[model samples]
Target: MGGLEGEGPDRLLRSMVVADSRRGQGIGTRMLAALERYACGHKVLALHLLTNSAADLFSAHGYSRLDRCAAPDSISQTAQFSTLCGSSAIYLCKTLSVGD
Candidate 1:
């Protein structure tokens, strides 16, 4: 569930979650770092995510909030963007380096 989507350099982080009971134990932080490392390994230039409640968490990890309209077609067309997450969901992005 933690992987990128889209064509070429337009990657999006499809899913990242941890059980509520396991939260605050650094799992999400570690998982996100690992996810970024994996994405970087595959040459993903940027990562995007949609969230309703974890904006603070993502922000703390270096993701910046973005307007929904800023999403490119590759992200806007996804089922997660069009249907899964609610309209109030926060859109976030971060540029990545191969060494990230």
Candidate 2:
């Protein structure tokens, strides 16, 4: 669901999905909450992810849309930034402040 920054400054949350049968059970929301906690605990400044169809879900979780053309340097080099995610892919960001 997420990657730790073993060799870099930021972590990557590549993919998160709940089984089809589990949809609407709040599992995805819980997963995202856990990921946010992990990021905050690790002192990560922000969390970045791309979604093709779950933009609403992310928005509900406090992530804001980011312009791909203006993505931050730290995130612009990620796989989601470079290839896996297409130009149409939605970029979302969430800042993790102290005590978050």
Candidate 3:
């Protein structure tokens, strides 16, 4: 799932879960790639996402961990930050160029 910024300028990617049976088949990677494509198409400047323990997966796809205290205001107010994910959840951001 994902949330788009006002008029879709930025996007917050959330919760990418492939069934355990489907793990290792590149489904999660494909989903994230699609979101990246969408964000680039919309001219988004950056994409943010919070993950509890999936840092490796995100890192592989170019996301970098952000210091929790320095998280963007928009990410701080997300439902994943406020409730769903734990306080120790890792915040990650990826800058996206308009093309490629």
Per-model TM values vs. the true structure: 0.92, 0.87, 0.85
Best by TM-score: 1
Error of 2 at 41 (Å): 0.5
Q: Model 2 shows how many backbone clashes?
A: 0
Name model 1 segments beyond 4 Å from true: none
Q: Cα deviation in Å at residue 54, candidate 3?
A: 1.5
Q: Provide the lDDT at 2 for model 1.
A: 68
List where candidate 3 sits over 4 angstroms from the true fold: 1-8
State, as a TM-score between 0 and 1, how close model 2 is to the true structure: 0.87
lDDT of each: 0.86, 0.77, 0.76
lDDT of 1 by residue, 1-100 (tens): 3667776776778778899899999998888888888888888888899988889998998899989999888888999899999999999999887777
Which digits, one per residue and each the tens of the lDDT, describe model 3 over residues 1-100? 4445433555678667778898788888888888888878888888887787688999998889988666666666767667887877888889898784
Better of 1 and 2 by lDDT: 1
Please report how far candidate 2 places residue 61 from its true position, in Å.
1.0
